[model samples]
Target: MRPALFASLLLILVSAPMTADCPCIPLTHVWVVKTCNDWNCASTELAVANGDPQVIAVPVGMNDSRWLVVRRFTAGAAVDVNDDSFQLKQFDGMDGAVKHYSGMTRDYHPMLMTAPDGQVLVLSTKQPEPRGRAVAH
Candidate 1:
């Protein structure tokens, strides 16, 4: 075999995307919280890796609350959220769609901003879509 041929083959193999045979795709964990009040009481945390997602939602009061949703996927997996993958969608408290935003992660942490009202949706596989929200492709 020629050295050039070997090098070309190696490059192709390296550039190829990782397959299921290799390992599970990376899992991203995002945490978003905001208070019903206007005070500085909002906080968010995000992390990404090869793991599972954990979503939790808790009601704060009779008319105010917060939701925590986890969206997971393979390292290179893409879900169709508002015609986009690896993105987040915000619904108007089970009503209309507010907006669509992409995930921004740096150093295994996502740089996502939290919202005050409505529900949050993250695109991932092996999970059911949120109620009253569009499903990812």
Candidate 2:
């Protein structure tokens, strides 16, 4: 019944991270989204919502290229991400991971990293760690 206790509970609930990437996120609808090549791309505020991650349009020849991949995670598949989830989750960037073609399976794409939480992290050809080419120091 205390006001302070109620306030503290509210703060904790507000700060919690939502499981948006689960059940494998989706692509934003056509026309409203942007890609890595656009010079006047929309800012974070005007960008797609968490429920709309579908790649509406990609850069020229970007789809088949091994350099970039935009996608959502699958249910129960943890993204297998870490504190660096920022770079991996960015909507556009060149520092992405390098998907190892040799490591890919017949059923799945080369970049899909399925974690236990149903998070499928679609890394690029420049991702760090097992995906990156550089030896970690």
Candidate 3:
């Protein structure tokens, strides 16, 4: 190959984005579950721009991870929540766990609460399936 053409090809190869071995799941929003004391509770369909930072007690011996519910926008507008799906994600330091919905329903809602020690507890009407192998990029 010509020197100039070879250099150009090398540059292209070097700059090209590396793709994952497996298909990546796009993660856009994160929802931290919180407990409600009364009849009023914050709306669940909140966007990324609004994050609730109210500190709650974490459970005993739960010194590491934070529980989160994640959502991906597969349709509609950027902030719209129509026809979207929710997944469970847990983060403990550098490692994390995720649970995907094999079949999600609108009635299945989840809430998060923290123990006095800062350990998070995930509560939901419907139990999530086994931890998922799928990962978000």
Candidate 4:
């Protein structure tokens, strides 16, 4: 092989792994619950450009409990809610534990709450599964 061609191929092979292993910058957004009802709560939406911590409320009671629901806001958004670069964290209070959610089964709607000790809990309604055709294993 030509010396120049061999050197070029060697350089490409050495740099390929580095580029693949490059870490991605984290994308974060905080939603502050302003009002609550039996079903869902209203939250303040902060722009994606703002990289500040929005005020989050601790669950007061069963009626005032809130869940951090994840979804894609835009069709062409760079990061999806289930992406590793995207992260969701819940805090009980200023000095409470922080819960991180990533790479979980995607549900149409999931009710999630963070305990005072940073445990992530899920709330689900007891409903019978809809009938569907079974697939052969």
Candidate 5:
């Protein structure tokens, strides 16, 4: 191969951009998740342009790496909830817990309590599932 061609090829390889990283899940219309080491690393609150916590405590949950309902915080923030980037106030400095919390409609499944364990509690606003066919009285 020509020397110039070989050098050009080398330059192209060197100048290529690295793999685009996975995007962070936005917690509220505010915070987003950050990742490192091929795993969720931390939860960071997005400054309100002027630097202030979004100040909304949407409940967060922790699943056991299986996305199953392990526990749910009815009073936490999704601001870093969809991923493992939330801080557990009661878990004794246990950070880096993945939050699968999703489906929010005017802040009303859960209210005023935390699930037995922290798992992403999908907010269900609809009424309970029907039991059988309806009948007129």
Candidate 6:
């Protein structure tokens, strides 16, 4: 094949929007709380309605405990909230009458907690529609 043809094909492949093989349930909201001490605490919330990428900074301190609250979560979905160092555990609604790990089955809200670590928290999801794509001039 000619160089020009090969280059064109490569560009098309590179610029095309990538899609996931299986459908994913979108996350509506996420709340992160960090308790540094008895009185000092910090929290951040991310609303993922538009499927845009979100990020939050974890303050530097000896975090006594950390909690994460997520809404619109589904079982067996490709959802993840983690830093490079550690990943948060996933809980599916509830188990029987007893609530497990602060998870509520009524609204699909699950709470997750982890050890004190990580610098930044990043959240991203693949929306049903294709994201922005590049067009060659």
Most accurate candidate by lDDT: 4
lDDT for each residue of candidate 4 in 47-67, tens digit (9 for 90 to 100)? 332433333333323333543
Q: What is the TM-score of each candidate against the true structure?
A: 0.20, 0.19, 0.20, 0.25, 0.21, 0.19
State in Å the error of residue 54, model 2. 8.5
Please provide, for model 5 over 9-48, each residue's C-alpha lDDT reduced to its tens digit, 9 standing for 90 to 100: 9888876645545576645222222222212221122222
Better of 1 and 5 by lDDT: 1
TM-score of 6: 0.19
C-alpha lDDT score of every prediction, in listed order:
0.36, 0.37, 0.37, 0.39, 0.32, 0.35
Model 4 deviation from the true structure expressed as Cα RMSD, one decimal place: 17.0
Which tens-of-lDDT digit does each residue in 1-137 have in candidate 6?
Answer: 69999999988887664643446656433333322222222233333334423323343222244433333333444444443222234332324213443333323333233222321222222222244589999
Poorly placed runs, candidate 2 (over 4 Å): 1-34, 42-117, 125-137
Sequence-dependent TM-score of model 4: 0.25
Find the 10 residues in a row with the least total lDDT in model 5.
89-98
Off by over 4 Å in 5: 18-52, 57-137
Cα lDDT of model 3 by residue, 1-137, tens digit: 69999999988887665542546766433333332222122233333326534332222122223323333333332443323233333333221122222233324544344433333434344334354488889
Instruction: Name every residue pair that clashes in candidate 4.
Output: none
Pick by TM-score: which candidate is best?
Answer: 4
Report the poorest 10 consecutive residues by lDDT, candidate 3.
Answer: 93-102
In model 1, where do residues sit more than 4 Å from their true spots?
A: 18-137
Better of 3 and 5 by TM-score: 5
lDDT of 2: 0.37
